[model samples]
Target: MHLVVRPLSTVKSSLFYSTSSHVPARAMVYAQYGKPSEVLSRMPLYRIHKHTLPDVKPQDVHIRFLAAPINPADCNQVEGVYPIKPPFNTSLGSDEPVAVGGNEGVAEVIALGDQVKGFSVGDKVVMAQAGRGTWRSHAALPASEVQLLPGFNSQVSLVHAATLTAHPHINVDNVEHHIGDYVIQNGANSAVGQFVIQIAHAWGLKTINVVRDRPNLDELKEYLTSLGATHILTEEELSKRETRSKLKGWLDGRKLRLALNCVGGKNATELGRYLDHEGKHVTYGAMSKQPMAVPAAPLIFKDVSYHGFWVSRWTDTHSRQEREAMFGDLINLIKEGKLREPVWEKVSWKLNASEQENETAFKEAVNKGITGFGKGKQIVFFED
Candidate 1:
């Protein structure tokens, strides 16, 4: 059979590993989808695999898992609610075809295929595509799916390592906006939200940040302000008519050209309320678990538009080099300390632990992720 995905570049793996050895991976996988608590059990999650890497394919890279985050979307996927699903095939070395559960993580390259290039042993890599199953202890993938983080000065936090794959922020210029155009977004405290702030700021874009009122509201506001946010407001304030007037007056006739909405329901409509003519509202997440409703006024009178973005679907259409280039820029920003990693709770996974123990900890992490906004992200790291 022919490979569906091709390597981004072709060259010899001489710069990488010399030994060809079998590499087994411990991964969390499920054959059928249902409520995560019910469908995601311990039986098959840790299983043997078919591609134990006795010999690496020409386009494959062997990777040792470092850290992987348990994202809410991942849990939703386990429940069979997420839109993009991983391919279930017998290749996972299971009794039947099953899909792995992780979407984002960091890894160390242990070996490379004969035709793989631009990577060496011990090099760090971040997931370049969603549904690549980073939950495993090891993985062998096509070079196109992983972006290399240089072994040199470009160091990143373990949290950043797992999250660099979550939302592949499109090149700002690729959006329907010009430089210095005003963009507004709610959930500015989210991993993706923080990234939007730094990315927009670094690329000469201005962002108006919005957040739900929290106990540490002042501190969170201060933190976002330091990241080059031009304006920040709470959800309560944004819902007010007077606040919109104030926002318009403060901008001095500059149109609020784009609104990034991660929280849906009324928050989404409110996000579209203050826009320049024909503004675009791109919704990437629905943390509120609410449906988006748009007022007819903006649609008929102002030509405001609503669209959805999912990073997993994006990888199917976009070039690997483009995704890697975006990753490179983000990595550079993190290395300089300009972009800060979000708060996260680290979960240690050990092979010696009873399967029941692993299941309980993972279940806890999943629940935390579902509820863990502003508090922190749930990250799983292996203990040596």
Candidate 2:
């Protein structure tokens, strides 16, 4: 990895946001941890003070962010509740140390470091590091922090690439899912759950999805079914014996190999009854805000395996090469149309624009990311 040392004179003028095209940038920042609505603020970039008579650093690349999505975890980080907290620093224009908001976004290399090897100007890249302050119009980062996609192909849309990091782990290690195995999941319409359906489809795995009954439940069911969800059931339906029997017969006596529990509570417990002997139950989220309650009988008699899934923790134990291989495979699936991204409410964030407009765009996107506005993921994209 190369280190970037900016020139002293250049750093002085760029201290509170460089008006120079060399590193024009702005970011969503927070000085103190608190609620996203209360603490998050739009701030200018502040380059480091260094020697005068400088140009773009040899080991630094200026990124023009194409698009970024606001994930639930990103909001949690801003609230100071996430395990992996972004470091707060005076890198941006501020009296006190501050951290930039956003974890996933795609950017293009408008200007490249003279010593940069693999990446080049106009090459598209995504954030390789978590909490690297992605919700910005422009950024000057070390070449190592970003990754150039295979073949340096710009064919991948920013929307699709921005979503890539959010859900690749459902198909990786932990539970050892196999092709053609029957897998079950709750919160079937969620971003993570949707990816599970598509990835399972790509691998010939069948899914039995569980969701809460909603006013537009049928439409949502149709959408997921189109994404290759084998069966869709409401929480009430999944909890009842009558509906359970119907699915059991549909399985034709094949053991349900895996149960993915994102929504805990009675609904989650009800899923265990259908598992085959020694089957695994993986809990990834508690959308219902309820604790997991597994019947004692399953552990004693049926020999069920109950496990929790945490992507951040998984990355810590796995090698970078392993993670990259999985990501590359998923991207190919998307390219082949074997995986489809959920419809997003695109929020246009213009670069080098007014503070009010930029703030409005980000505020709206962040609000939607929290509220799931229009029942879709919220993405902030640039004009050019």
Top-lDDT candidate index? 1
Scored by lDDT, model 1 comes in at 0.75
The 10-residue segment of model 1 with minimum total lDDT is 1-10
Off by over 4 Å in 1: 1-14, 40-53, 150-154, 170-180, 352-354
> Which numbered prediction scores highest in TM-score against the true structure?
1
Candidate 1 on 15-117: residue-level lDDT in tens?
5443335654567777877776556445455332334544677778777787899888888877778877888877756778888888888887776777777
Clashing pairs in 2: 8-50, 8-51, 9-51, 9-52
